[model samples]
Target: MVEIVPFGVEAWLNKREKSAKYDISQSTIASLTMHEVLNLDGNNGQEFYSMLDQQKMNYGWIEGSPEFKQEVAKLYQHVEPENVLQTNGATGANILALYSLIQPGDHVIAEYPSYQQLYDIPKSLGAKVDFWHIHEEANWYPDINELKKLIRPDTKMICLNNANNPTGTILDKQFLEQVVE
Candidate 1:
């Protein structure tokens, strides 16, 4: 028998609810549903009610609709709708990206203390993973020189969380451009 492990932030978050005193987790729809804070106005509520009335609950849309893909693609300046693939959520997206792009023994650099999936999945896939640490003393931002030092000739990927989970630190455009360079 093989042991299966939780693969991403979503799994950890689900487990966290048991031990958590305060519900500070951000990624679940349950939070909104539990709080009864999701406001549906205009056609949104009508469409939802109509779906319920028709008993139309299937798999929803397979691979999302064309308009949905186009909307997601618009977020990236140069990306086309055909290039945008939607998954269950960001965790699924991350897993697919890593599974498709990384091979065993590949070198990967990932930001420290991010969503665990960023690095852990690659490790499970047999990649050599390095953490570019972000210091709390330095307002949780990673130093560019330190990041540069972590990169090696064999590095196949650099994974990051733009707005970090748990810390809520945002990586700005300048820093992202520096990372790209």
Candidate 2:
């Protein structure tokens, strides 16, 4: 069994969220009701009842519904509807991806101070994980030169967060192009 460290942000939220008047620590937007979600999906609020009556709501689709997958594919350059996947959430997606890719003795470079899962899962998988520091001094972006230095011949994977999570520092396309080059 893998031993993962406790997630502090969740703990803090669980402990402090109820009492806190203005919660800046809330990572996502306020929770929405099923009706609000259906409305946002461009359906009438009553669609939830229609869905429950017409479709099986007991379980999720294996690869997501064709309609949902097609919508997801539209967001990417060349992704196909058949190739698009749906996970439970971001953390589950990260776990699935990291576990699938990283093997023992592999070299992985993950952005420092990003989501803990990005670095932690790879390290636990027996990969030699390197941190690509993103500091405020050079702005939030990791130094491309530093990245170049970190890449070894044995490097199996490079983990980059387009937007560093806690800081919400985004790496734009031109900077990404430089990294790819």
Candidate 3:
């Protein structure tokens, strides 16, 4: 029998031990409810209730509504609304991008001590995943030279997280572009 392990976010959430001493891992809805900050009349609550009240959900929009896509497109100056295809969240978007772009046996480089999903999903897809470790001593940013050394002929993808979880380190655009180049 083959042993099946959970992938991506599920694996991270299912961990028996906390990843950090101060990790306050919990449900967002439950936390908001406890704090009394989750008002039903708020933006999401109102939209959610309106949808629920609809006589027919009817899959709503197949690839999400054009208006919704347009709104999302506004976030990027260069990206058009037609390019937007909404998913469950950022995690879903990341998974979709990886699944659509990455192939088996491709080499991928991912930032370390960040979101496990960033690297794990590629690995699960049979990609040879390499880590670019962020040193705590160096304020959690990986050395540029170290990253340059990791890039090779087989490298197909590079994954990173902005405002890295647990550590909360944000990668600036300049550094990100350097990695891209």
- List the candidates ranked by TM-score, beginning with the highest: 2, 1, 3
Instruction: Give the runs in model 2 whose Cα sits over 4 Å from its true position.
Output: 34-44
Candidate 3 lDDT at 40 equals: 52
How big is the positional error of residue 139 in model 1, measured in Å on the Cα after superposition? 1.2
Q: Name the Cα RMSD for model 1.
A: 3.5
Instruction: Give per-residue CA lDDT, model 1, range 23-59, as digits (tens).
Output: 7776444535622332354554666666569875577
Over the stretch 71-178, how does candidate 3's per-residue lDDT look in tens digits?
989998899988999899887899898989887899999999767777877887888889999999988898889999999999999888877765778888898889
Better-scoring candidate (lDDT), 2 or 3: 2
Candidate number with greatest TM-score: 2
lDDT of each: 0.81, 0.84, 0.78
Candidate 3 error regions (>4 Å): 1-23, 26-55
Q: Give model 2's TM-score versus the native structure.
A: 0.86
Candidate 3 lDDT trough over 10 residues, lowest sum: 26-35
lDDT of 2 by residue, 43-102 (tens): 675666676788765766787888999999999999999998888887888889999988
